[model samples]
Target: MRRWPRIAAWCVAALVLAGAALGSATVYFGWYDVSATGPHTVPVYALLDVASTRSVKLRSADIDVPDLDSPDRIRRGDALYRAQCAQCHGGPGQAPEPYALGLNPAPPPLVTSARERPAAEVFWIIRHGIKMTGMPAWQYRMTDEQIWDVVGYMRVLPTLSPQQYRDGAPSGGPASSLASASTSPSSSATATPPGDMRVGDMRVGDAKAGRAALQQYLCVTCHAIPGVPGARHYVGPSLDGMADRSRIAGVVPNSPDYMQRWLMDPQGIKPGTAMPALGLREQDARDIAAFLQTLSNFE
Candidate 1:
């Protein structure tokens, strides 16, 4: 027994010595390629990708999400994004700015990243900002609606093209957004904005009223989120769980006040925003904000 124990300790020591020797050789012999041009090996890249996604998702778990599918919200989002985000993230048409590509860990194309994330995760990154990366948190600069719009656009980016992105600028070139819609059902809480600018808290009991207001106002004609069973259309990001987000444009701390302010003048928060001044009243803005807040009850 004593001999076996001694032999086992020697074997362990030998293994450690061999590992250190191998490591020293790898470093001294230039066996490990450190070139940027060399892409990661398949297994290495796969492991890294898994780790990256899990890290983002874990950090994103606490982030509350708002509704990303409304036209007003997305339009406002576009406005803020064009001014700040487009340079790095790019859009359907615009390529990433030079700086974004040159960074060590290249900025993830949001259009592609969305497929891997929940809207809340996207919103969290927008609000909290990432470290050692080109991405910045919009917190303090933009409103909630604006962030949701970017999230909404991201949800359906796979279907966009460079031309559509250029045209989709809210500045009115031609191509407008056509991102994917969430399949989640829109509850009474996720009511659409009213036609005549009536602003107020949405009542679950008044879902019928909210639905009526949605159609009468032509809200669905151009913008469409998942609403009342089976009527979903791809006009906008689905409003499956809008009420839960913590901020807007990944900037503003989510609040009814900020939401209303954004609806009235999204451009004030971000210059060159695509969202137009919609001529909204205080109440109109509030009512719409109320409806949008309901999109993420699940999150």
Candidate 2:
């Protein structure tokens, strides 16, 4: 019996040594293929896929997802996805760009896969992006709401056809199409023209420039603004109907000067608020104020 115990220990030590030798040899001889052309071995692929999925699930468990079914939210998400994601993930009707095919671990079609994921997981992946995959951390470029918007559209993407994608996709990047449309004379939804819409005693800044400044300040990440295409945020209050509101933060009067000051330094205006001071230049503040003033007729 004592001999048997010794023998078993030797067997375990031998197996460990053998594994170490094989691993070292593989690394030393460069036995693993790094080429993208060939698919991974079945075991390797299964391990990687499982690991990736589990990682996302574990990490995204705490994310609080919002209502992702709103038509307006989906539209905003569609524009953003077309501009930033279509090349890699493809749309309902759009094919993945040729460059995406060359990726070693091919990007899965989100139409089917995104449906399989929870919106919170999708939001986490979009916000933090996966490492070693070409996916980027859009936290720097896109806002929380914008990320959620993409998730929203992705949830419904499996149902869309190519023709539907073509018909419904917004014409350009959010920064361009929405800005131009908001300023176009015929783009107003209400009976009165947006150019003629007025806020009492408040000077409207240049609408076009205000739109540009909005992008520059990265306001789209937190506030969903009407006429701003993919500006689907939920972090802060929606600025869509700000023009008609009697108060700015529901505490102060909604006047041009108050808005400009608020824009210049939000924390100063409302202490302990979640809004950040984007450090808008005086003119930038004016331009944003002017653009926001037009929201009354935006619909």
Candidate 3:
């Protein structure tokens, strides 16, 4: 009987070693397909989704988003959108690039996406970015002001009316579009950016109204603050005090219009950017900017 116990332990150990060898073979032999095109098996996908969500939450705990929206902020945001984001994500009433229409999660329109997540989550996704899924991180290429402008614009994109897409005026991409849009030779605290509607080069509407509309859109997902609840992993940035940031997405001016442009289609500004275009309408974008402008880091 005593000998039987020792024999059983050896048998179990042998089985475990065999299983390890099998698992290794599966990987080394390319038996498991890693292609995104290959839909995940139900169990595998479920497990991965759970793991992804958990990992994002754990990894993004330390990120921060500056006060993002303001009269100046939203305008710049609007410009950023026009110059960099408009094509892929579109604004107010337009649609995203044909690709956005077909993407897996079907890029939620920011107008509504903000409501779905917190501001910090939005910001983290914009800054640190995502892996695989074509969502590139912007921490390297962009400036802080640029990122925040996008954040502020996202807050109010859900309320815009619509913009008519023009041919060949401007496009997204850091080098080409940003160099032209980054600095506005003429702008004031309340004045808007020119030519680009999303950039807020021109005034959109009431600031207080914009702020209210932004909160209604739910711009407080992933952002951290002195008091907002929940962890910062819902997929966007928080907006407790977004108006004070000097930059957006680490680039661009922090104006309402600019916020509009960046929020409408951030992928254009930073190619492969994970920040999904919320398909914001023009009026919605403006409102979001207005709302963001109200947030300030008053000491």
Best by TM-score: 2
lDDT of 1 at 11: 100
Indicate the worst ten consecutive residues by lDDT in candidate 3.
181-190
How many residue pairs clash in each candidate at the backbone level? 23, 3, 113
Best by lDDT: 2
How do the residues 116-201 of candidate 2 rate in per-residue lDDT, one tens digit apiece?
67888888888888877678899999999998898888888777754455557556743233234334544222123224424454
Model 1, span 134-181: residue lDDT tens: 467787776766677777767766566554565566643222321211
Give the alpha carbon lDDT tens digit for every residue of 179-213 in model 3: 33323332111234233355444355676555333
Model 3 Cα shift for residue 219 (angstroms): 24
Return the TM-score for candidate 2, rounded to 2 decimals.
Answer: 0.56
Error of 3 at 74 (Å): 1.8
| TM-score, structure 1 vs. true | 0.45
Candidate 2 error regions (>4 Å):
171-299
Scored against the true structure, residue 47 in model 3 reaches a CA lDDT of: 67
